[model samples]
Target: MPNAAERPRRIRVQRDGPLIVEGPVEVVGEDGEVTVSHRFTVAVCTCRRSQIYPWCDTSHRRRRDRRSGPPGGEAG
Candidate 1:
């Protein structure tokens, strides 16, 4: 492996879930708003239902019909 300074950041994508990114990161929304995260690891939300936008609040864990909504379904 490379030394600490050369270590690569890692990102994980689940088969049916969010993108897990190594953190101390920031996300920019379409409206130009920024969301910052300082955690060692961050679960970036793919579904727009997170109350804590840009961060996964496990909202993708909810179940619903795929044909009617986003990933993990409509949550109802």
Candidate 2:
């Protein structure tokens, strides 16, 4: 039987950005370097803009994000 806790997780794509993963992982870069990291969460690049490649550096936030409301100078 496969160990449920040892299985690699598949990243899921959010509505606006790269896929988010939160389980066991084994990642390999194009240069053939491999790394295994365990965390409560992880993010994989989808837009291919990451300098580190395949990782989210929060760069996508600028392309897909904008405030929906007006300036808050008078909201107080």
Candidate closest to the true structure, highest lDDT: 1
Model 1 lDDT on a 0 to 1 scale: 0.73
lDDT of prediction 2: 0.62
Per-candidate clash tally: 0, 0
Residue range 22-63, candidate 1, lDDT tens digits: 876778899988788878899888887788878888776674
Relative to the true structure, candidate 2 has a C-alpha RMSD (angstroms) of 6.8
TM-score per candidate, chains pooled: 0.70, 0.56
Computed on alpha carbons, the lDDT of every model, listed in order, comes to: 0.73, 0.62
Clashing pairs in 2: none
Residue 44, model 1, lDDT: 86
Error (Å) of candidate 1 at residue 65 is 2.7
